[model samples]
Target: MTSGTSPQANAAAIVGAARRAASEGAAMLFTPEMCGLLDRDRGRATANIVAEADNPVLAAARDVARELGLWIDLGSLAILRDDGKWANRGFVIDAGGEIAARYDKIHMFDVDLATGETWRESAAYTPGDHVVTVETPLGRLGLAICYDVRFPALFEELGRLRCDAMRIPAAFTVPTGKAHWHLMQRTRAVEASAWVISAAQGGRHEDGRETYGHSTVIDPWGDVVLDMGEGSGLGFAMIDPARTAEVRAQLPSLANKREIPRSAS
Candidate 1:
């Protein structure tokens, strides 16, 4: 879902999407980054959105998780904190309406693209210090945001944690996404030997940002099981634990890694 820079409206849209996913028999629902607000006006956007725990949208998401008896993964949000810094956080709401786990995005996108696009997330948000993996009904799940997808070490850690699946929620720029989105996503899945469920913000937003849509779910074999092309709607696919196990057993690359030197002297 493409979120405008409105907190209330975006929260409502998330709740609505959760209800729809539940109605469709999805055991879990996932949304994209900036699920709350994406405003170019930094001050207004920060003021309108929740940058901390126990905010309205988090509460509403927990309630939806309870009502639907399904897991809800709300993509990264700008969490306002008293420390005067924002955290790029993701939530994993268990079926019982409890926040089972949370993960802050570790990698910050501090790039100056040649296409006249630039972003310095570190200016407004503090980077998370650790990699997090959460246990779920399906399997251990790794959490990551947009720019984090480019780092293979993060996925390596998740693989070490025995994660069977990973969620990469992104609001990718049109240029980058069109060039490397599918290739990178499929590569991560194959490397980790885990199913990848990527929910993305498609289309242009009020912030004048165009996200490359085509939210996809890839099987452990690195095959696209479902792809919601450049549009706004629900995409669905079944994630079987058996498939993950089968793929790992067939090709155990994770167990065959060689330790590398930490640095050059």
Candidate 2:
């Protein structure tokens, strides 16, 4: 979604997507990072960034989820933490409109790009310190956010937990998306022997920032099942749990994994 600075507008987009998804026979819907209110301006964003209970976008999504009887993986929202900091928090609302799980993004995107774009994510958001997963219609779903994809340790933990599918929603920079998006996603799926479903933010947004919008899905075998290239819309793909089992049986990487010895100085 090309989520803008307005919480109301973003909520509408999410509700519409949920309706469309349910109508299309989808049992679940996944969105991108900052699915609600993607305001880069910290000062301006402060007004809209409220606690989770008070967030209108989340409320609307919950209401719609209950009405439609659909599960929604709301990619991530910028939430005002109680400590006066912020959190890039993702929510998993079950078909009953109840929050089944919440995962705050652990890896902060602090980088200076050659494209002249610099991000100090840790400056605004406090990182979370837990690996979270939940059971859904699609099976055990592991959760992670945008920049978290860069760290393999997180995915290793998800693999160790034997997640059936993983969600790595993002609003990626154009340069990095072009460079490592598909490669990293496929690698993660192959390494874990799990399905990877990544919804993404696409197109130019209201805050004058452009996002690389290739919302994609990769099977356990690292094959691209869906790629909604450079657009702001919903897409769908079928997942087979049997395929994950098949791949694991063939490679057995997870079974063969042994604790690495400490590196010598």
Candidate 3:
């Protein structure tokens, strides 16, 4: 369950999805990254979005979570802060509609592709310094966003922290997603021995930018439990915490890890 449009619309869609999933006996609902505004023109996109702290959209989501009695993983929002800048922030809203925790995206997408896909997120947004993991009935959950999936060390750190699951909400470009999406995701799951729930933004937007939408949920054994493909729809999977324990017990890779020094330029 994710969105790639206006904040209000995204918020409404999330509430609807949450209600529907709850009716079907779902305990939690997760969303996609940048679940608010999407503008091809970066300048204009920043202008149209809201601040995370007092956003009407987030408020609505909180209300819905409270009313539905389900946990809501509000995907990353473009939050305009008082410092005249924005942050890519994710929120975990409890069943009671209270904010359980917040995780800001630490890895900024700063790439220059041969396909003319150039992005320097750090130019416009600040990076988060802290790693965030939250406790839930399911297990300890680590939080991440789009480009963060490229870094395996993050997942390993979460594994070291004893996290059972990780969430990656993305709006990946078609070219990149096709080349490395599944491989990267599965690799992370295998290395960390944790389940991954990745909700993605799919289809071309009104702004003319295309997203590679293959919302996937992978198990600890590196198997894709569900894949939503390149379309607009909901994908669901039941995650068993025992699977993580089983996998880790079978192959304890974490205990054999060693730190090595690197040369500095």
Candidate 4:
């Protein structure tokens, strides 16, 4: 979704997407990172970045989730934490409108791009410590955000937990997205022996930032099941739990994994 600076507008978009997804027989809907509001200007964003309890986008999503009896994975929201700091938080709302799980994005996207784009994510958002996962219609779903996809250790831990599927929603820059998005996604799915579903922000947003929007889904076997390239719309793919079993039986990498010893000084 090309989420804008207005939280109300973004909320409406999420609600409409959920209704449409439910009408089409989808048990769950996944959204991109910063689905509630994406603004480069921190000062302007501060007004909309309220506590999770007061976030309109989250409130609307819960209402719609209950109304349609569908689960909605809000990719991530800019939330004002109780500690008075901010957090990049993601939510998994169950079909009953209850918050099943919440994940604070651990890996911050602090980088300088070749295109002269600089980001200091850790400057505004505090990093999360714990790894989070939950059970849903998609099986045991491991939760992660944009930059978290680049860290293999996180996915390795999720694999250790035997997650059946993982969601890594993102709002990636065009340059980096072109370079590592699909490669890293397929690798994570293959390594974990789990399905990877990533809904992404596409097109230019209201804040004048363009996202690399190839919202993708890859099966456990590293096959591309769905790729919504540079588009903003809902796409679907069928997931077979047996496929995960098949891949694990064939590779068994997770089973064979061992801790690597530190290099001798």
How big is the positional error of residue 171 in model 2, measured in Å on the Cα after superposition?
0.5
In model 4, the runs with Cα more than 4 Å from the true position are none
Work out the TM-score per prediction.
0.95, 0.99, 0.94, 0.98
Worst 10 residues of 3 by lDDT: 1-10
**Candidate 4's residue-wise lDDT over 100-144, tens digit each?**
999999999899988999999999999999999999998999999
Task: In model 2, state the lDDT of residue 106.
Answer: 99
lDDT for each candidate structure: 0.86, 0.95, 0.83, 0.95
Comparing candidate 1 with candidate 4, which one achieves the higher TM-score? 4
Q: For candidate 3, write residues 1-265 as lDDT tens digits.
A: 3355576777788778888888988888888888766665776676566676668668988898899899988778888867877888888889999989888899999998879988888987888888899987568899999999998778888988877889999989889999999998898888888898888888888778788989999988899998999967766789888888898888888767778789796
Model 1 TM-score relative to the real fold: 0.95
RMSD of 4: 0.8
Q: Candidate 1: global Cα-lDDT? A: 0.86
Q: Where's the lowest-lDDT run of ten residues in candidate 2?
A: 77-86
Q: What is the lDDT of residue 89 in candidate 4?
A: 96
Candidate 4 Cα lDDT to native: 0.95
lDDT of 2 at 165: 99
Residue lDDT tens for model 1, 55-157: 7778888888998898999887888766877888898999999988888889999998879998888888888888888888778899998899999999988
Name the TM-score of candidate 4. 0.98
